[model samples]
Target: MSTTNEAALSLAGVDKIYALNSRKPVHAVQALDLDVRKGEIVALLGSSGCGKTSTLRMIAGFESVTRGSITLAGRRIETLAPARRGVAMAFEGYSLYPPLTVRDNIAFALKSARINATEVDKAVKEMAALVEIESILDRYPTSISGGQQQRASLARALVRPADLYLLDEPMGQLEPRLRALLRGRLKRLLNERGMTSIFVTHDQTEANALADRVAVMEGGVLQQMANQTELKERPANLYVATFIGEPPMNVFDAKVEIGERVRFIVKDGPALDFSATAFSQAARVAIARRARAVIGVRPHDIRLGAGDNAAKVVSNQWLGDQSHLALDVAGKLMVAVAFDQVNASRGEIMRYEVSSTKLHVFDADSGEAVSHGAEAA
Candidate 1:
């Protein structure tokens, strides 16, 4: 997190609403408060209709802010026209001028900045090459493929000099290999130029690969914002705990029983018993205060071979680099990942272990996190 003085963009309690003539208004964004540091890259990450796109539009001045303020480069920009906001944006729809060549489209903003024609041409070519659209520079937008047009759109927005850049699914149309290649190049370009940017992406890999930090949104609200590792290891709540992980975190409803030893009894399932020394005093106190909790364990943390718990193997798949096992633990499905292949058959009994140090406890009622591992959240 950057200090207020170092922030390049800030949204304070921003909201966006669409009024209906004869019905209740739709709140697209709700009290969004975010800050992007100078030279930092952030990703707005969420599923479709989670307010991620609406938040981007509001920041770019395409949608009106229904409440609160927007500050960019030390100026209030909520009420400013898009052009006056000093923000360059790449649209997911590829809003390129159909009549113009790709070269001219990329040069449009540079021309507006009063750069000479020679410099504009040079800048356009560099950006086009970076996005792998150099060969299509002479082609019109209407004649180019969707992927090519998307690159052209990206080139146009990135070629311009601005205080900030907002990219909406910038390389979504590109194939996997190309998308991965461009992600590296784009990251380098942003770093070399010290460009402060915020990109919208529903793809978790894209967000993790490109951004310094990721903001996860859902139901018109911001769930959590942090770097990739923090988002994985210390998710703020249940929504983020399940949303950020691969294969998702395996969660089970349980009641915490405090005694000589701490025990988490799964609802009509197995009991996870642990010594009192396994958890910190604060973690024990927090767990004791809750009537019920949802315990989460990552797939990778479930150890196979031997332990107190017995599970029936449902299925096992060796996915080239790793093995994924689906097991039925006391009637509950639990997925586990292993680096080595497991010679187990369906319906076979297997011993597994879930250490208390690998547990994440959440308040069952409010869905808020209570503790992670041995520490209180």
Candidate 2:
């Protein structure tokens, strides 16, 4: 395990296992390694049952680490009590005191530290304004909407000074518009304060918009961790490529054919030819060995009008600024996003071109990206 001298939070080979009653132990987290720098925000991103919440719980000391270690500011903290670690957490459940007004709720943490009345008042006011809940300051938790309650909880977490902050689905209860609004505000606030923070969310938009880096997790395992640009342009594997995109990348089984120009033929669908120099040595070797491979392309990377691959439009959905076209190519379903008006209708056969410059080749068996645009020369 590597030690980060200045990391605000570090997890080295961390594991969380639940010993069941008369059954096998469940490994909820497995040998996870991650580092978050001081004053940097990193998002723990993945789908449900991916161990994101379990990892957060372990960090907060609500769950025990079965093995390995966690450190905060160079101090080992996996064994520390939740409060002893100086970390503030806001959860999806508001966890607000129902009898208390918003102001009192936000002031609770500060008051617990025996801060003076004047200081508490000033801090509470600033936090309410920051979370844009000043108008609801005097309202009891039970009387306010879920969004309002979430803001109050967030403010409570933010009002107190702490070495680190953890927010688990803080905006999960809000409507889309409200979530977007709070996401922007929360991101800017965290940046301005320079608070070391970890945001746990399943929403990709939330992760991409807010965090400096994102750690993608899967069933009890860390898949990949990288900045948004790296994840998009150079995904570590097929799962990252498929899971990180909005509409998701289109992937289909393909065979590489040796020719003057290497050709990729999608099973029963389409074929694209790339110059020999366009392929990397690894890809060339894979092709020569007849290793199973797949071709992936983002929807926006497919050109609508002309190519060797002919597809029939299954459906077209007009979404204002753009349209989504569901196409059937040789009985396989494929999708493309058209920015301009598409002149085809359902059942209309059309020839389409894929941006050969933007192709992603993956080893079918291992599901890892082998090359980009066949590693363009």
Candidate 3:
């Protein structure tokens, strides 16, 4: 990670509000503060209407900031025109010129910068090949497929020289295999050139595969910003804890009681009792202060076939590589994943165990994380 002095782009207290006629104003982005270091690849991840796209547009100068300051390469650019912001953006809509061929579209920026004709052609060809669009270089926008058009649009933006690059759903139109292939190539290109970039995507796989860090957004608010591992193992709050992981984290309302043994009494369910030494002093104190809390555990952490607790298997599915089991544990639904295929049938009784080391505790009222594993969060 780079220091603040080495930041390539910075946003401070940025907000975007759209006032409709005779309707309440919509807050698309809210007091967002972000920093992108030189050569760092950051992914803005969120579901639809989560403001990830709005944040990208605001940074690219395509959307006006209702409030806040944007600085790029030491210059304030919030009020600047899109063309004057030194930022290049690839739109999700494939905004290629209908009359221009793919080659011409990719070479437009170079030509506008007064590069020689030979150099422009060379650059265009290289970019087209990089994006697997070399075969469609002579085709016009209307003559190409959506995926081809998307590649051409991406090549057009990536071929340009800019201080920062913003991509909105860059490969949304490609098939799964092609998307995965391009993800590697794109990461290599960005790293080789040391280009600072921010991309918007709803796919967690894309974000995890491409970005050095991910900024998660929800309801126009920044939830958390961290690398994939941190977001998974040490999420900032309940929203991120549940949102970042696949199958999500399973949470249950519980009452904490610390004594010779630490016990979490599930609401109208079972009691998960553990040794007091399983948690650190800080974690014990935090849990003791809250009478009621939420306890979470990942599906992968639940071990089947050996424990005191009994559960009824609701459904079991073999996903070719792993087994996904839905269980009714103490009257609550819980999902567990196992690497090996189990021969258990629906309605069969099974034993499961979750160690205290795999447990996560959060505040019941605010949904804020208190501890992860045996340590304080």
Q: Encode model 2's per-residue lDDT on 166-247: one tens digit a residue.
A: 9988888788887888888888888888888898999999999889899999988998998998898788888888999877
Decide which is better by lDDT, 1 or 2. Answer: 1
- Top-lDDT structure, candidate number: 1
Off by over 4 Å in 3: 1-5, 20-23
The candidate, 1 or 3, that scores higher on TM-score is 1
Please estimate how well model 2 matches the true structure, expressed as its whole-model Cα lDDT.
Answer: 0.85
lDDT ranking, best first = 1, 3, 2
Please give the ranking of all candidate structures by TM-score, highest first, separated by commas: 1, 3, 2
lDDT, candidate 1, 128-245, per-residue tens = 8899888889999999999999999999999998999999999899999999999999999998888899999999999999999999999899999999998888888999999987
**Candidate lDDT (C-alpha), each:** 0.91, 0.85, 0.90
Please provide TM-scores, in order, for all candidate models, with all chains considered together: 0.97, 0.94, 0.96
**lDDT for each residue of candidate 3 in 1-377, tens digit (9 for 90 to 100):** 33234889999999999783438999999999999888899999999999999899988887899999999999999999998999888989999999898888899888999999998988898888888988889989999999999999899899989999999999999999999999999999988888899999999999999999999999999989999999998888899998988778888999899988999988666689999999999999998899999999999999899877778899999999999999996577899999999889999998988899899999999988999997888
- Clash totals in order: 0, 0, 0
The alpha-carbon root-mean-square deviation between model 3 and the true structure, to one decimal in Å, is 1.7
Of 1 and 3, the candidate ranking higher by lDDT: 1
